[model samples]
Target: MTVLLRSSTTLAALLLLLPKTFVLGSVKLVMQNGGASQCQTLWAKHTIAVGNVCVEADQRNPEQLIVSYETRDGWKLDDAHLWIGRNISEIPFMADEPADDSKRSVQQQQHQDQPYQKQQQVDLTQFPYKKEDLAGKHENFGFVVKLQHLGYSCPDTQAFVAAAHATVTARSSIRNGNTPTLQSAWASHIEPMKKHVLQGATMINRINQWQDFNFTLVCDIKNDPPEGAPKRHFANQVPK
Candidate 1:
């Protein structure tokens, strides 16, 4: 019957869509430039619909980069920021931290010794972004980013965006075949919504140096909550 056919089609479409909607996780990154882009302070704050998500980030380590978050119960530390680095080992889970702070002390010592061993790198072969070249280095030892939008969501979005806000771009490589490289970049635009502020992120990358492609990611935030909704008081809730 016609109705049976329609039901079957709907079911097939949903079966294909479910996997895409479920996100593994997310990050909230706040890069606070204290008047100087070079030496500007970086804050790895937690993901918040609006305002600061972690109490420690707001109080104890007010200036440090605190990438914390809030669940249904309350705020907690979020180590998702480590994804920016090529090695997941660099940013271990909270449980991995030792009891007496010995682990942290060792990490700090190792970090002090490692200079060129940065958290990020650039790969021209992978074609991470459109015309993504090192613009310049900041005073605080970070690189200035200059890239075009790809208009599509690919593996490069995470690295490209993180390079600008967080640490260096540590991993970049070629994929598929031995070609020149893919040219892609994501564009950032503003879209106003009734209940939340919408940010449309487009990815525009060079598919093969000869052709171009595009992708989009619409980031929505509830800037102004209604009377009944819980009020967000933190100013550093922006996603990384």
Candidate 2:
């Protein structure tokens, strides 16, 4: 009877020591500046064939920011959250871009014509990417978000930054009955991750410690286009 009682106590102790939560796999963040051109340059410099993520200004509309990611085998990008503003705190509360491109163009024009207002006027903008958007393009995929739509105007001399939070899941994790749902996991981790970024935590350090990944890219939007680049035009302006 004594031996059985000891065994029961030992089992209880082990259960107490077990972690309360579990993660199916690692999530990595890779942010490259200057959009596609910058990504290409980094690949050549590092002698790598491809990159995990790329950020670039839209070719037709410089004010629009495009974020691209590479699809990986055996893993799926369950959730991707993005925020952009003068700083980290300002990002989460920024306004979301309109779903329709035409509507966004009109919004941009209105934003430009109006005088600049305080950041508090903008609403919380959710990350724009959805998993279905990447359908069929197994190799890679991308999405665009306009800065003007987010309440940032062009011709402003200040520099702004963008933060991307991606939650990836291993196929095996999904199959495991013990794993928590993606929604629950996101709810548990999002605030803490934001706190880490606000504190200026090193991403490599976090990755080594098996934490969620966060990355940022600095962007400088200028009033004048770069030399030899296409002239800037408003979305509403039609060519004669």
Score every model by TM-score: 0.15, 0.36
- How high a TM-score does candidate 2 get? 0.36
Per-model clash counts, in order, read 41, 2
Worst 10 residues of 2 by lDDT: 1-10
> For model 1, how many clashes?
41
Best by lDDT: 2
Note the residue pairs that clash in candidate 2.
35-55, 35-56
Query: Model 1, 82-130: lDDT tens per residue?
Result: 1223332332223322233343333344454432212233332333312
**In model 2, where do residues sit more than 4 Å from their true spots?**
1-35, 38-51, 60-63, 93-139, 151-154, 172-240
lDDT of 2 by residue, 1-240 (tens): 000101012234333443333211111112332123223211211222222555555556544556665535444455444454565454434454344434333334345444322223222235444443322224455668765565543112233454443444445555686563322112111233222211222221121111122223221211234459876668999866
User: Alpha-carbon error at 20 in model 2, in Å?
Assistant: 56
As a TM-score, model 1 comes out at 0.15
